[model samples]
Target: MVKQWWAALIAASSVLAGGEWQNCFNGKNLNGWTVKVTGFETGQNPGNLFRVENGLLTVSYSDFPNNSFKDEFGHIFINRPFTNYHFKCEYRFLGDQFPGGPKWAHTNSGVMLSGQAPETMEKEQKFPTSLEFQFLAQNESGTRTTGSICTPGTYVDVNGKTIKQHVIKSRGTALPAGEWVQAEAIFKNGKVSHIINGKTVIEYSNPKFDDGTPLTYGWISLQAESHPIQFRNIQIKELD
Candidate 1:
């Protein structure tokens, strides 16, 4: 009876350990990711652009010097490629400004999906040729809202209606600045979904770019576009 109980306990532990919420970021190093761009470089060991703290993977921009901006476009992309999966993360607006930064940088950041080769992007290119799950904060113009889709080279449709504009129509009420929000993207069977705080903010299908080409799979990346943003709880589960 004692041996049987021990075996049962081990089986249960293994099942729990193999469940969802697997840590993508190693937390101690950039082992599973690749960085591409000029003017910017990874930070100190174990605690850099992507760090693990208190069981959370934090993408921080605080360690770099204030004058670090020298047109240094940087991206930390997942080394592994994914085709159909559900990705989710928790993000917070740092509200910190950099010297000589763009005026709207405070409300700017995004997650690039179906992304291009990081090395293929030209040195002067500002963004990747992929679909962007744009994360925005409340701004003076009121155009920056969370859960909006921005197609760099792709477009989405709603209810069979093609979206002519680059930006999608906002789904829920705008979230105030300086708060953490949960964001999720479901990519399966040539469809995608953008969800915010448990609410389906945007749902569209048949994502393709301006050239009328379909995106089957690509790397996932996070942007540090002249603004301070932090992301945690980054995880992805593969789909059949």
Candidate 2:
């Protein structure tokens, strides 16, 4: 069933308005998306955790009770499954990490691809089954890179070898927290590539579930990993 859906979507290969690339985000509101967050029922955004202002989509925490970050991880998902395309966006960190958020979560967020639909996720599920293009800021220390891959409930083969570890580092350089960084992922069949700022940093193939089930197509989601982040210029280019 899933495989059939993947094939149908991939075969469509629709071009975006006026060109080969389509702007997934309309830059005004969350129109073609769904929200799922922990500590709240699915689709219940207690705070304006996901909002757009001045044409920038922001994940904020100003409205949570006590204005504290309470592990309320969230995802804003594009409303469909996709395959064989290049997804790209620009993002930057903003403000300090809300109190009680994990130290590692400061300035950390991701774009999750090949993920299950928001309706299928458990109410308290921490993450979806997908490949995460983990975006990290320099945090002023200047050692963390932005284009790493974190597999949650999935795995991928890289360099002809299966990596048992969860997070795979990319070769991209890290950028400062305040700067908008360009992050992208290209997918064809089961092969995936992560690019940061126009540089190809990671490449892997044969993405599959932990139980060895193949993962060919799924939803695209922007993560709210307990931080304030902003994303802009979200677009995709369907490939042949």
Please provide, for model 2 over 1-240, each residue's C-alpha lDDT reduced to its tens digit, 9 standing for 90 to 100.
343344444543252223288888998889988999986776777678899978999998887665676678999998877767899999999888878899989889999988888877788888988999999988566778779999998889999999858999988877877899999999888999999989999999999888887887778999998778999999988765
Considering summed lDDT, which 10 consecutive residues are worst modelled in model 2?
Answer: 10-19
Q: When superposed on Cα atoms, how far off is each prediction in RMSD? A: 10.7, 3.1
Listed in order, each prediction's TM-score against the native is: 0.78, 0.91
> How many residue pairs clash in each candidate at the backbone level?
2, 0
| C-alpha lDDT of candidate 2 relative to the true structure | 0.85
- Give the lDDT of residue 44 in candidate 2: 79
Off by over 4 Å in 2: 1-19
Among these predicted structures, which one has the highest TM-score? 2
